[model samples]
Each structure stands twice: as structure tokens, then as C-alpha cells.
Target: MKKRLIYGWLLAGVTFASSCTKNFDEVNTDPYKATSENFNPNFLMSQAQIQFSQTGYDQLLFQSMWVQSLASTFDYYANGDKYVLRGSGTGYYSRTWNRGYGALTLVDEMKNLVQGKTQYSNLDACGTILRVMFIQRITDLHGDVPYSQEGQAKSGNVAPVFDKQQDIYKAMLSQLDAATAALDLNKDKPSSDLFYGGDISKWKRLGYSLMLKAAMRLTKVDAATAKTYAEKAYAAGTMTSVADNAKVLTDNANGNSNSNSDALLVADDFREVRWGKTLIDIMKTSNDPRISAVAEVSAGTGKAANEDRATPGVNTASLQIGMPNGYDLNGGATDISKAPNYPGTSPANPAVPNDAPAPVGKYSRPRLTVYDDRSGVNMLYTYGESELLLAEAAVRGWNTGSAATHYANALAADIRSLAQMNATPQAVVSDNDIASYVSRNPLNTANTTALQQINTEYYVVTSTTFNFNETFANWRRSGYPVLTPVTYPGQYITGSIPRRMPYPITLPQTNGANYQAAVANQGPDNFATRVWWDKQ
Candidate 1:
């Protein structure tokens, strides 16, 4: 009876195995997962674009306030406003590093998908330009970063050594030169491009424009290299007009909302964050038309109403008062109430029940219609920025162009660029108004302050467009606008503004040897240390 039972079980097992083996490949394959062979590589371009463009709290928590473009009294923003650690401060420090690398990884994969394919030459070249762009930003933010072995984890390079910033810049310029030259307008364009909708001509412009910016960054440390690349970029053709600006409009319906808009719409942030006095004062001093286009005073009274994102604010340029940085609503000595030129608290709202006065209600905030639009455009690189860089290059005796002409072009281009920020065109400065404003603010190349004037306008243009990273970087490099370091009691760094952001706090543990080596060479893994280009 035992032998009969064993024979029966063996027969049943054989029958089951034979049945399962009939469709083994079909059963194991995942239909939902896209393979390289099946997936369209163009889709990754959109992901890369959105990911890099959506900086969110990464820039806001540090560069924005550190550069004094926007100021916030909220605890989280103390990371920048007061140079003190607050909620998720460590996490915020890692944000750019993590996000930037993540974006680079996507671009790397996208490139690999079409690396040797002749039909996808444009995609490959565009990916190369994007790779250079991301590497430039990463090295700029942190002194040394993984470049040669970056995004090679799948190929057994789990621990990539950090490359020196100087080497990285050299490599970036070389890569940009080849990539921009490789861009053939006849080739197939990236169908999923977020900027310019797959226009190869515009991509060519963006590539050269980015090259110009990267080259200009080396002015302080490597003027010869700067001049070489700047002239090359100018000859290759940088952005010539606002139409060549590289910007991406967020699609809220598709769950790709503008990160800045989302961050600003947070009630606490929307309530307390205001235009910095340094920024507003400069605009007001220059009689800048952007003052009215960018800033607004809260409409209703009390904290409840002031925090309301639905209601529009008063955008009269004269009434828009900027709040000073390093001050808060903590009811301490550094409270907003104790601030100089304090506009006083907003009147209590009768509609609300026992609401407190908004500490920053009277201070200028970013206009809701302009800044809080979920579907707003993210201005990446602009024609204005390119022209400004060329203007500086010309001033330094580089064979770029006339300094006065480039500077004036930048001024006009920047004003026109504002209208592109909103989805429905909120900050519309008319051509007549833009031309009039540009005429009034001439770039006197003869003055000793030529460089200062050019860069200060660069500061204002970048700050108003909410590109705080560039604003901070340019401020450090050019030393324009002359921001006073915030001397809050428990600040992290003293005596000067942060030259570079600290590496991710988790770096030492995750990549110990590489992280230590970087610190050893780059100095201390702190904010006070300068990158290669930010020369003393």
C-alpha cells in the first residue's frame, strides 16, 4: 500500500510540472514594467527636466534667504534666514545632492538607451548637455562631487570618488563644446522635451547659453579658461532673445506642479515669507518696474486673512514694504515687531474669531496670481542671464560683444521674461513699458561700477524670477549687491555669507572613504569653505 501511494504522488507531481512549463516565459514576464527595448527614451527627458527644475525647499531653505532674495520668519526657513538648523535641516542639506544625482541618473539611463543609435543623435547630444548642466550645478553647490564614476552603481561602482571642482569645470566645458556642436537640426528632436517642445534650434541655443554661463563661472579662478570658453560659446551662438529662454510650464492636472508654487502655498510659508528688504530696497531705489510686477501687500487684516491664499493682494509698488531677514515672530528680541522700519501689524479681522495680528502682514509677499499658480512656468536659464554674462565677459575684454548693448538687452529681456512665469500671463510688462524702463537704466560701461551694476542687475533679475540658486552663486562670485551677513545669535557660519552648501549629513556613513577624502581636500565639509571658482 505504501509503494502504491508513492507512485501516485510522483505521477501527480510530474503532471503538475509539465503543465506549468507550458507557458513559463509568459508567466514570469511583467507586462507592466517597461524594458529599454520597449520604452520610449524620450519620456525620461521629461522626468529629468521636471525633477531638476522642481527644486522646491532645496533652494528655498538655503539659497533663497541666504542671498536675501526672499525672507521667512518660519522655523524651517531659519536654515537660511538665521543660518541655524531647524525642522528637517539635515534633510534639506541633502536635498540638492540627492535630487541632482537622481536627475543625473535618469539622464544617464536616457543616454544609454540611445547611446550608439544614429537616429537618436539629437537625444544623445541633448543628454550630454544636460549631464554637463547637472554636474556643473552639483560641483558648484558642493566643492567636489562624483563625476567620472557618477551613476555607475549598476556597473559595480557603488562608491564613486568625488572629482575636484576645477577638473569638473574643465570636463563640463569640453563636453558642452562637443555636445553643442553635435546638435544637428536635421536629426529627430526629443518628443518629450519640456523646454521648447523638441525644437532642435532652441536646444542648440540652450546648450551654448548654458556653456556661456558655465564658462563665466570660472572668471575668478581661471580667467584664461573663462575667456576661451566664453568666446567659443559666443561664436557658437547663445540665446539671442526671450524666445530662446529655457523654461518649463508645470502641469498640475498631471500631478507635475511647480515645486516653488507648492512650497509657497503651504499656509505657514505663505503667511510669513516676504520679499527681503535688501532686494525690495534695490528695486525701489532704482525705480524698478518689476517691483509692482513681483511683490504685493496682503489684502485683508489679521493672521487668518493674511495667510489666505485665495484672496489677491495689493500690488502697488509704493505700498510694498520688504521684511528684513533674521527677524521672526518668536516674540523674542529679534521679533518682527522690534525690526527697524517695521510696518506694524495688520488690523484684526472682524470676520475671524479672536485672530491674532499677522506679524508680516504689512510686508511685501510674492503675488499670489504670479507665484502661487500650481501650473506656473519654471524659468531655468534665460536670455537675460546669457546676455548679462556676455556683458560681463565683454567688460573683462573678452571678444563677446559690446558691454552696454548686452546689459541693456538683458534688462529688456528680463522684463519680458516675467510674463512667461505665470500660466495665464500675470506679470505683463508692456513692450513700451519695458523699453522705457530699459532706457532709464542704461549700462554706463565707462563707470568703475560697470561690473557691479551689471551683476547687481543680474542679482535682481535672478531673484525676481525666483532662481535663488543662481542668485546666491552669482552673488558669491561677483560680490554684487553687497549683502550684509545676518548675525543671528546661534547662526552656523560667522563673518561671511555661505560660500557653498555642506554635503549631505549622511555622506560620511554611506560613502565614508570618498566623503572623508573630499573633506580632506575641499576643507572641513562646512558652509564657510569656498568652491574652486569663488576666488578670494
Candidate 2:
């Protein structure tokens, strides 16, 4: 189904290639003409939307969380088998550049295409919202980033100045507000909205929901402003069910089949990760129906995670002894296979050996089981995320909605989302599983414990995504889903858990004065110090 594109914008000197045209002067020839119309704008939009989760972007943010470095790397796992995120020693400077800043390449495209287009206002609005989301995520993870000048690289921004994280947020929030306000269900549908397929109402809902998320980011430093913005976002409608969950429709390369979320989840990071004890305990405690879906229980994981499994703190388990970050440095079928935790050293399809393998998925990093399907498109935003935002808002009395109900809804959405994987080979968890969790946990809606549960859920669900940008965000804000310090065989640095990733090595030369100023304001150029948000 390859569609022809608009060829009116091609350059004068460029030679055009085409099967349909008779001659060069006969047909149109624009550079992005084919890219613009043939691309199924929906697909293009989705590509931008999922940029943060894409291969082009995964290694930095996603890999960071998978490895659980406050600022650096260690190994990883769903079962918490070893220690540190994969490929340690050097912090992921390039990885961050791609996943975070690199993501802007696509997101900015969406922004530029939307400018001044009244006909595609809905699409434009949607693009703007997503663009802001990606931007905020980037700055949040990497402190200051080049915002205004980023993407203009060809026009002389080869080395853009880094904007402060605080300033970046301010700009992002402004954009989000504009996007939200611009959302009009009455506006013409793009007929190409891949996320919701021309559903303006859905787009509107997502915009508001994203607003809540952005606003929530300010909670630590500016609670009053956070609450004000939170209220505004809630006043706008939000997702009410799982059907409204927003994710791209990802397909395999030969592009024939649709894989499961876990395919992507357990794909590469699978090599890098095992599991952490804290996550194991949480799943086991609630008799968590999703445990089996997310992780393979270690020989003693069930017993180890369950002191009193019915308990809320029942724990995701403890001290998983996560794998070292670069455990598979040798990079071979044999290296990835003999993880010590994996049951068989040899896989069924060796060509596609060691997880998704080369020809299969082409994923460079390891993955967790939760993202089982690499084929599923990037999850731009979801109802589950919206509800959690609402729950947090309600907790703060920022809005009038029932926070408890939203909290429960948030948990329920993930459970249902993971229901299949959650069920064991022996038996599927039914109403009994849900009831047991709710009763024992006793979500008072008013309790920090309830909030913590949801926050923890947010971290796990987020941690299981493509690369772990959001997972780190939650960790900084709430301090839940506790992870132990990584004791790398390298320099100890007192084995102190890292609090912030150091500014990239290039920053000193690139934006020396501003970078120095930020460091001074932030106090302690060392990674051990917390960010502005981590008061606790």
C-alpha cells in the first residue's frame, strides 16, 4: 500500500526517481513530497510520538532505568539476578544524546509541520502535545538541554547551548497549555490520527492527561503551581477505560507480524537484566496477579518474595543482586545464554539467537518480560498514566475527583493490561486475586501507603518500557520502588547510591559558563547529591 506523494517541492539540481512519471519536467519533485503524503501522516505522527521509546532513543533513557543508575550504569534483570546496569564504567553519554536529545529530531518535525496549519489543527495540536511531552522528558533526564536551538543543526546550531532544566520546563508547560487549549473536538480530524484514528475527543483527553503529568513534575519544587495546573488538567476530560489507552501499532521489519509487548520488553534488555528484590516483593505481596507475566520466578523467588504474600509490602522481593551492566560484553550467543539464571544456554532459533537476535528484532539492548512485544508501537500516553496522575492530584487535594478510585483504577488498568502474563501456567488469577489485593492493601485513598503502591506500580510499569526515562522520573519524585546501591567491582566512591547523572563530559566546553552556574546552584558537582525534587 505504498501511496504516491506530493512532488512539488523538490530541489532544482536534484534528480528525481519515479516509476510513474514520463520525464523530469512532467511530474512534481519535492524533497519531502513523497515523505509528506505517502507516509500516512498517522504513521509519521506515531513515529514522532513513540520517539522516546524507539531504538533511536531507547538506549539512553530506557537503558538507564533498566540498569537503575541514579546517574550511571550497572547490570539489570526482571528477576534481580546480578548487579548494575549493563555496560558500565562510562556513563551513557552518547546513549543519552540519542534517546533524549536525539528524540527531538522527530518530535520537532511534528512541531514544525504543525505550525500555521489551520486545516490540520487537531493533528497540529496532537503533535504539539506529544512534542512537549518528549521535550520535558529530555530536559528532566539531562538537566539543561538545547531547546530553542536544537533541531536547527543544519542552520548553524551544530553545538546548541544547553537551557536550564527549570527554564525548559517553563517553556514546555507553556506549550502544553497552548496545545491543550487548542484541542477542539469540533476541529477537522486528520483522517490520519494513528493514535486514536481521527477521534478528536480522545485527542483532547490525552492532551489534558498529559498536562496533568507535566504539572505533576512541578510538585516537588512548586507544589502550589503543580496543584493549580493539576486542577486545570483535570478540569479537562481524561481516559475512562483501557480501550482509550494510547500506543502505536508496531510491526516487525519484514513487517509481517505483530509481536507481544514482552517481545520488546524481554528482547535485548533481557541480556542486561535479571530482577531486583524490591520489585519481586511487591508482586509477591499482593499475591500480585502480574508477577508471572512480568518475571520468571527464581527457584526461591516465590518464597523469597512472600513472607506473608497477602501483605501489601509483601514486596517485589529484595536484593536481586542485579546483573552487572556489561555482563555480555563479550557479545555472543554463548555469553547472553549462560546468564546463570537462564535455564537453557541454547535457544530454539540460533540465527535469531540470544533473545530477539539480529534478524528477528535487531534490538541492541536487553529487555524485561513486561515489554514482551517489541512489535507494539511506542506507548505515547495511556489511561493508566492519566489515572495515576489524577490519584496523585487527589492525594494533594488539588482536584475534586476521588483519588482513591483513580488509584484503584490505575492499578486495575495495569493488571488487566498484564492479565495474560500475570496468570500462571498452573492457574489464572480471577476475582479472588483482585479482591485479596484490595482488601489487604486497604487503599484508604488518604494513605501514603496507597499512594506509594500506585507510585511503585508507576515505576515498575514505566521501568519495563523501552528505555527507562519515566522510571527515573518517578524514583526522583517519590522514592518508592526502592533499589539497593550497586557495588561495582570498580572504584567504590563509597558505594554510595548515585542521585544524579553528572553533566555530560562535553558540557564544560559546550556551555561552560551556564553549565558552571547550574552546577554552582545545584551544589556538589558530584553525582551523589539529589536533584531539586528529591527532598526526602
Candidate 3:
């Protein structure tokens, strides 16, 4: 199955060509290899799911640190930690846009093959859900992106105009609703379904859950639409438990390793990236059980020990200190050593060549065994997210369920989701621990406080799962776990947390007219500018 999925990924990228000789048409076609006409469209859906969900450096360089879920003093991460453009920063700005559209193109091809075909009905619906989920991410990151005519370049419409974010949200909601309604359990299931093994019922839950998510994105900008769809999504049904989580298990044997793990394993990233103080402090303050599950302190002294991926770290919650953002090892005023409560540098080993005291070594990095697994699960969406969204909706007086019940459920689901990140189940938080934590931290009754608590937990859950894009988006929308903007020398933004990533640097040359128009309508294409739903 893994090999076949890998083949699908490879095949998705190829463009088939035919021989000019009319008499040799039959001979030209390879019987062993699959072509569009004879290929399984489900493979396209599988490829789309993997490509869209594997958000490697795309989110790592920005969203991860923007939300202060993970922090780094590494210069490469300065683009996010210090709000400054460093190495590959300019290129990173375009990753989400380019990769997202590329995946959407696969979905478009899949839809083209499967649409209106009875046997492919479920595949088409699943593809639509995948398409909307990804398009939402693209527009959320780079506001007013090409949507209406997206992926139509092969049809000679290469310069598709950027659609209004408002219209895009509406269309996404409508498509999600229709797709959820269209899923038929009796129809054929996609053979290469990465999420649920082509269970149409689960796909229906995911579609409606996505509807709930898309609806919630409109809460600040358009409350009426938000309420209507949130209610509809709830009524239609969302993920009922962790069993309904939408995730894909990576296959390292097939060269499809977890992208987050690959990025973290990079030597520079391995040594510097730590769970941020903002996130760890919140968990510690709340006595959140997940703190120990998600974080760990390096096992020994010196740079070599800290960067060693083979040795497991201690995950005692008390020892897990988070590194603050916007500090570096530049040996100056802004050095991490100068920060308050800075864990002193690890001892330098005389035996190790060129080994200096490992700066920021005492601070917590993501538990290597759990998070750095090449074949770890990539969480696309979770039952925790669905429940939390419902909890927020309930707080706003929408008919979802009891705010406390949903909040508690979400908390438990979030903790349980950690087990999925690791290969060994014994390394995860226990059910007793999860239950106790949920009991101790029931939803605060006051509406505003409740909102803060819910979204803050949402931030923790998504961040720990490495769903950094969603973490950043929800933080922007809910204004929870309020973060102070990092003030670093030579920063990019104007003394504020960035709200949106700028358009790809090449947009002016590739699609100048539409790019200019989008900038005009959506405000300047910069970090300070918010997307349509991110109303102040």
C-alpha cells in the first residue's frame, strides 16, 4: 500500500505523451504503466492528501514561531522568531502559495477524472473537501489569492485574478456543505484513501467538521454567516471522537517521511528549535498534562549531546523550561544568555573538538522520540479542533452543545492525540492523567474568559501537533494567550506581530495586474495586513 501510494505521488507529477505515428498508437501505450484513462483516480486523491498535508518548511519558518509554539535563536528561523527576513526568508514567503496551488491542481485533475461518475462519486466529494480545506489555508496565509480560476493555467488562463477573501470563504462553505451532503456510504470507497481507508461516513464527518472550521473563520467578520453554518455543521454532524481524526501516517520506507520531522532533524534546527516559553508557561500554569508529553530537556551537557537525535531526553514537566523568542547566540545584549531566567549554558567537553558551551541547551526541545520520527502521523484535522470549535460556538450562544462538555472533551482529545505522534503508546500521557487535567481545568463560566481559555487550549493542541498554520490563524482570530510582539534589532514588520504573509516575491512579474489589484483591494500585501475574516 505504501509503495503504491508513493507510485501515485510520482505518477501525479508526470505528463503523458503520445506518439505521432498513427499506426503505432497501440504499441506506444505501455500496458504495465497507468495512464489518465486507465489509472485509478483514487490515487490522485491520495497524492493530493499527502502533498497538501505535508507542510514542511512552509509553516516552520513563519507560523510555528509566529504563534510562539516553537522558538529558535537560530538565524535561519529569524524570519519568524525576530520578524526578520534571513536565509531563504524571501523564498519561504512563497512556499505556502506555490505548494498549496500545486496540490490543488492535483485535486482539479482528480475531480476532472471522477466527476459525474457513479463509482467515483465518493472520491470526487472527498477531493472537494480536500480542495476547500487547502484553499482556505492558502487564502488565510496570503490574503486574496487566486481561487475562482485557480489551477486553470493549463486551460490558457495562467493569469487568474485574485478573488476576494470574503467570496472565497462563502464558496468554501457552500462547497463543504454540498460535498458533505453528497458523500454516499454505499458508493465505492477510494482504494488509496490516506485518512480513513475510504470510509464514506468518516469522510462525511470530516467534511462537516471542515464546514464547522470554515464557518468559525468568518465569526469576526460575518457573524450571521458564521452562526448559520456553525449550526448547520453541528446539526449535520462533526467528528464525534478521536477515532474520527483526519490524519495520514507517513511511510519512511517508501521515502515519504514526515516533513516536520525532516525539518527538525536538520542540524541547525535540531540544536536551536525549542518549545517556546509562551506555550510551555501556559501549560505549566494550567498544569496541563500535555506539557510532559510534548516537551523534554536535553540529556547531557555540550552541543554534541544536545544535538544528538539518538538519545532520548528527560520529559519531566518541571525540568522542561521553554526558550524565549527573539534571542540569539550573537554574544551581545540580545543574546539568550542575557534573557531573564536563562538556563545557563551546558558544560563544554574538552574531549569534543570545537565544542563550546551549548547556549540555550537547558531549555526544552520537542521530545525527539515522539516528534522527530520519520514515519510519524501528520495530523491534518483532529476531533479536538472540532470539539473546541463547537465549544467556542456554544459560548457565542450558538446551538452546538454545552461549552464545558465540549471544552473538556477537546482537552482529552488533545492529550490523546499525542499518542498518535509517537510509535510507542506507552510514552504518551495516560487516560487517568488526561481525565484529572480536564477535571481540574473545567471551562471558566464568564464568556470572555471562556473564549480566551478555549482558544488558548486550541493554540496548545494545534501547536504541539505541528499544525502551526492553524495555531497562528486561531491566535489572530481569537486573540487568546495574548502574546507580546518580539522587539528585535532590524526586524521586518513595524513593531507588531505579523497578521499575513506577503504575496510571493515573484507575483509582480508573473501576475502583475491582478497582484496590484489584489493589493489595492486587500490593502498592502504585507504582514500587518489581515485577511478578510481577521477583523479588528
The lDDT of each candidate is: 0.90, 0.55, 0.89
Maximum-TM-score candidate: 1
RMSD of each: 3.0, 10.5, 8.0
Candidate 2 lDDT at 237 equals 77
lDDT of 2 by residue, 1-536 (tens): 12322343343224445543566554656656555445544445655544445543234333343335312112333111222333443445445556656656766666666567577777777777777766766656556567877788767767666666677767777787888788777778766555678787777777777778878877878888788778887886778776676666555564522333333233243333344434544555666655544443222222222211122221132312233332333445424334445333212243332332221111112223234344544554567777888887788777739877887777667655443221222212366666666556545665677668778878655544333556667677776766655433442233545555566676778767766776776665555566655545
What's the lDDT for candidate 1?
0.90
Ranking by TM-score: 1, 3, 2
lDDT of 1 by residue, 206-231 (tens): 99999899989988888999999999
Q: After superposition, which runs of candidate 1 have C-alpha atoms over 4 Å from their true positions?
A: 1-33
Model 3 lDDT per residue over 1-536, tens place? 99999988777645232233454667676788876678788788888888888888999999999889989999999999999999879989888888898889999999888766788888888889999988989998887989899988778998999999999998999999898898888888889988999888999999999999999988898999999999999999999998899888888999889898999999999999999999999999988888878888888889888888889988989899988999998999999999999879988778889877898889999988888898888898999999999999999999998999999999999999888875565238887998898899999959999999999999999998989999988998899889999999898895789999999999999999999999999998788999888979
Where in model 2 is the C-alpha error above 4 Å?
Answer: 1-43, 55-91, 254-272, 297-372, 419-432, 445-447, 464-467, 491-495, 503-526
Worst 10 residues of 2 by lDDT: 358-367
Structural similarity to truth (TM-score) of each candidate: 0.95, 0.70, 0.94
